[model samples]
Target chain A: MGIQSVQIGFKHICIMTTVLIALILFLSFICLIALPSPKEIIESLKSSEMIFSLKLTLISALISTILVMIVGTPAAYALARFSFFGKRLIMTILDLPIAMPEVVLGLALLLLFGRTPLGTLLEDIGIRVVFTKIGVVIAEFFTALPYAMRMLYSTFETISTRYELVARSLGYSSFETFMKVTLPMARSGIIAALVIAFARSVGTFGTVLILAGGTYMVTETLPVTLYLNMSYGNLGMAITSGLLLLGVSFITIYMVEKFGGRKI
Target chain B: MSGFLIVKNIHVDLGEFKIEDITFIVDEKDYVCVIGPTGSGKTILVETIAGLHKPRKGVIILDGRDITSLPPEKRNIGIVYQDYALFPHMTVFDNIAFGLKKRISKKDEILREVKAIAQRLEIEHLLHRKPTTLSGGEQQRVALARALIVRPKLLLMDEPFSALDFNTRTRLRKLVREVVSEYGTTVIHVTHDFEDVWSLARKVIVMYRGRILQYDTVEEVFNRPCCELVASFVDINVMSGIVVFSNDKTIVRVGDIEIVSKDRVCEGHRVKVFIRPERILISKSKPVSKFDNVVRGFIEDLERQGNILRVQVRIGSICLKCISTPNVLGSLDLELGSSVYICFRSSDVRLLVES
Candidate 1:
């Protein structure tokens, strides 16, 4: 009798508790969203500075997403397919940014490009990254690269190397096989990585601030707008930027489920 | 030395499994079956021939040209995998036209060539569909069509029909025979199924633990296996029988039944008789072909070994295992507790001299 009553309690009580927790969490987001009036949000969004920050955010995220995919694809393919010395260490280091705080990554990039010989060597070549828009791009790339690599690495791991071998036997070169076979097979994964990368790059604040100084209307992105406005007690501006970020995230999630969900 | 394809001393170390010191040759238009257990390097040898894997130390010569350093694309070889890796993103027609597209620039000519082979393989109707929408047998045909459409100098297959149903596998075997004869393309196939050896192979290479145990004609390998490993692998039925001198035929008395063999045997000498299951025919009454050996036995049991249905019969103290089509068994109404006659020719019965 006791066991039967315990099973009944688990069936009802556990589900109810889970629903309650989820409901409270969702209500918290709703409360955060209601902090700003729609009219105040419209007024803040109308500001030219907010428009400039939004445009800069989209442009930098696009560039960083491209940069991440360009360098991450080959790195992910090699790590998934080949055996090399220090492979474990390399994988761990590549994944470290995703695990560590974004601030740490920003500080590390700041130091490396701050006053080091490599930084000076670049400065001699008329290229400066520190406290510049390029610094924002660099920070976003480093912050977004690990997630892109992880997505593509697992994608390559699921594909059979035999397909490449068959293409080669059928008179296609290795590079041709990669473009023709591996790329098409991994289309879903590439798209997922791109979406994740763009989202991460747009939302990157701590790293961008540390490296690019979150300069008003210059290195300021959407996340930087939110951070700077919240610090200055401009709740309307911060909440509007946060809402825009949420809309982008919602679109990305919908695109993922509609296109790439079945494949994954 | 004069063979069209020669693999001289191939050694590949893949950590978990390795094929060592492998040497073999195939004549023009020869169909060779590499038979072995799982992990015996059969697939590796076939892949090495296709130039997919480079030998650690060996020379691969094709048509008097040393192609040891040539890449797979330059070697002009084609391979079909067991899973039928048919480019899921491409239509069946595009998959078949993939290799031809590289060499033929004319769009119409490529279409004509692909259609020709597609019609031959009976997959012309499926040309517009993606591979994922096709059945296993249809997918296998598409894979075959893709490999054969390019008219490659050498074709390597790794258990190509193993993933198909029994009926489809049988039909594909006939199709393979027809295509090979029509194209006259030399082939190297890896398989664990005995039916592949019987129906498709002209020569057989038995491998064990990465080395060739024996390589010979189908007759030599089946009749006179070189070692116990090969014998057990081929599973030839051997029976202890005593030789008896008849008028002109050398008769062997196994249990209470007398069987005839064409091999020379002295009178009153003990010998071991070897025969294959498919070589023995089961009949409702005595067979009329003047077959030398005839024995009466009752059906002991029956079992299905892949597509071949094996029947065990009890004739006196000795039991014999034989295979026949299910239709034949049905037509004969043979079942357990049913009596039947088994007949075989003198040529099918080989006598190994026992001292």
Candidate 2:
């Protein structure tokens, strides 16, 4: 065969692989939605257990995303802007949650909150974390922080330091320059990071399951609800929870697609 | 001692590029242009003075105040980069008003000051547009207005006009000259373009390998460079010759050609001779003038650079570069391998140290 035909064959194979995988995923989602009658799915969604799980998931993800942004933005900026001692080590530690298995991260968190002195200090202050509702937010926060920070770091890196110099020459302090120039230029990136962080927080299952105990009707989130109903062989409730998580994933992908590119 | 700004023994180590013992002085309202090749530490010197990069060892005294350890915001120095570096998110009006807001609180006062500078820069109509929406020249004017509105003690421009077309650069040069004079602002402009030095510089600083080669008046630096490197940088011809005496006049014999000089040096002593390229006059035939040094040579190479044609003339073993206009080349009908007579006056030759 000639080179042109070989190149064309390679292109077709790659494209065919992509299409086949995408079609399989689409058909799987369709099977989940079509397995149950519409009336049964509606009833499962309106049930008290499903309602509590959905509310808890949304609230915990919201709180965790906000907390992640608050701590991650400055950390990412520091990583992107400055060169200091142990920066690589700190970055590797931050990326551990993203690279290691979610169950491993959850186990580490379990030991920290259950058997450590810091966890006991929090209990003394009446701020319970382990096996509590607050534990859900804590688990989600740790799970989502690395992705948010990675996105924000790249965003801050794409912004030239010359803009900050120009602002400084105009008599603004360092903090003032960051607020006026850096933050404004990073608007789209921050939005994309928030969407991804919220999505990651809401989809967290293993971490929340291990640390928050995944108790039914008390600390249960949407993912936890899916797991609990699967164990009880409640197919209607399990399929409904899976559908809700899929919807959140689609919205998150759309929002991120709208705001991912660098604007300034 | 009467200098307005003094940089004393500055040493900076930036790993890739460093400046050692870099020192210079600028009088008040002097437009100093720093010209050098790429990676010659031109930008680092300006950034150090702007307090963006602190020198390892140096003292920068502006207006009799030592701003060595001060932050950029506290130094009262304004800098305009080659890229303009305008806040892309802000309107042109807000950009010009940014520095003014730090000094003026009221909105009306800020508006008035911004309007005044914007009108002076002829960018008043572009006040509502973002920097990314404006043209290159328009964005540069906005940057200049933003820097000048605050009435800084000194302005540092790092090749601010290098990004524009020739016509726009010429126009902005004139605008900057007029506006800077009106504001009485001192400027340190770093550029690689010779036109910028000729048109904008009152004093020129020639840098090479992170060291100041020559810092003097523009005329002196162009006409009488101190060293061979400075001479080459300013497009001056540098040749080594031995001092010879003939008819009670000091002359230098360079490669079988004897050229007289007004400067006195001991006979039989080796010396370096310098001559400006534009000072050398080329002719199709030797003229009747006996006072000037005239020699016949063949044209070795011809290259056109903009309006000027750079002709390399071969005279024996040495090659002399001659600058002539294209019109002159056309009129003289000069071509490769064409024989020509080159003449230069004795007063133009200056003798310096050996090698």
Candidate 3:
């Protein structure tokens, strides 16, 4: 009886999915036909604000991705390979950002950078983060770190420790083995993580808005550009940025699928 | 030689498994096979010797030099794993050349060494291919070549043939023995297969529950197991009985059965006797033989394990298992409840030393 009901449920799900896909296609078609032409979209894209936001988004996303990989690789490797005091607590805290709401993370980062000793230390060092382009990268880094670390952690976890043991036995030090063997084996996963982190950083909005304040032509990433322009009743500019963000997401996912060969 | 390799009082506690008071030694070029069941800390002990694990307390001396604190890489020891841990990104040639590359600076010389070793292992044809494309036997040979090409102080194998089919395993065992002998490399092989112990091992170390139970020559460990656990692990029949007479041959009586063994034992002393299953012969009727021990019994059961057949014959209250070939079973037409004669030479029975 349960099997029969499951079979019926599967049939219903298949029908529902087909209907939902068709509805999405029809709505997309209507929107495409009703909206401005590609010429107008291109003209809007040529605007100085649009160009600046796109450039800033790419640059900051690249920086954030590099930062995330630099910090996340070692963090993930340590979590996957070692056992020390408070390891579970550290892992739990690392994973907390993944489950926490974006606004909460954004507000937490804002307070830490705006009111804490770290903020004052940075201020004394002449490194102004809050309300600056640097704040955007800092926010993007925090937002994308959890996702990048999760990918890298699982990737390192999938590789057996025996490979390192074999390398060590072959007269290579532990660090050398990791560099020559483990890192090479985990290359695809690292590439996938970079792609994902870059995409996440490019699309980040709430944290950037709270920390960088989303000022026009200064700290406006693509998501912030979309939000700021939409609030100003600039629908074409907002949708153009939206389409660019969608294209970036599409390209990143395509590259990850093409090169990674495994789901990240 | 003066104990070429010595492990003195090694102790390691790794939460799940621990080794305590482990002490053993192997002469130079001695092929020692460590046999134990799963979770017996056999792999851990070898890995510790390879410097993969730091023993909480111990000293590993190789050729009279203490390498207790040396890392595996610095120790110049090679290891071959059961999975054949070849680098997937590298060609077979590069995989074999990796360690040699680190040692030698010349590229052409590295190529020459790799080609020579590959030719020796008969993997020259597969040198350009990736490891994933090779068969289990080919991959194992490549792993062995990679380890042996380094010419390390010692070579360790962790159940290198356990993953292969029976035919592949036997073939690779012969190949491994030949290659290691050609290299004149000292080896420590860990295996659960007694065939490996019999065919390749010069020395046998039997381990149970994180401790060495017996370390001796292959013949001694197989023919004369040290304890009941080693006896069962080695699949030899162990019986505890009282010695009744001591003359040219020692006679032992178990229950109402009398068995004669050539091993020296005091008369009227209680002793445990071990007899290998393959040493016993099955005949349809009582045969004319002066070899002494012959008992008549009915076939209780038959079990086919690989090529050999295990025939269970009941002699009074004790049910003895005798190993025979399929041809013998077919020729004798031995069936259940058929009366048969179980014959074994007195010299084949061993008297275990009491602890």
Model 1, range A1-264, lDDT digits (tens) per residue? 999999998999989999999999888679768877889989989999799999999999999999999999999999999889999999999999988998888899999998799999988998789899999999999999999999899999998888888888888998999999999999998898889899889989889999988999999999999988999999889888888898888788877676565352
The candidate with the higher DockQ, 2 or 3, is 2
CAPRI level of candidate 3? medium
Per-residue alpha-carbon lDDT of model 1 for B40-84, expressed as tens digits?
999888888877677899889998889888988889888988999
Residue by residue across B63-87, what tens digits does model 2's lDDT show?
9999999999999999999999999
Q: Write the per-residue lDDT of candidate 3 for residues A1-264, one digit (tens) a residue.
A: 999999999999999999999999878756744586787689879999999999999999999999999999999999999989999999999889888887788889889988999999999999999989999999999999999999899999988888888788777788899899999989899998999999999989888998999999999888988898889998888888878887887899897897666421
Give each model's whole-structure lDDT.
0.89, 0.92, 0.89
* Regions of candidate 1 where Cα sits further than 4 Å from its true position: A1-18, A262-264, B239-260, B265-272, B281-320, B323-344, B351-355
For candidate 3, lDDT tens digit of each residue in B282-330?
A: 9997889765899888999988887889999998888887999889989
Clashing pairs in 3: A171-B73
Each prediction's TM-score against the native? 0.89, 0.96, 0.96
Taking the candidates in order, what DockQ does each have? 0.63, 0.88, 0.62
- Model 3 off-target regions past 4 Å? A1-15, A18-34, A262-264, B353-355
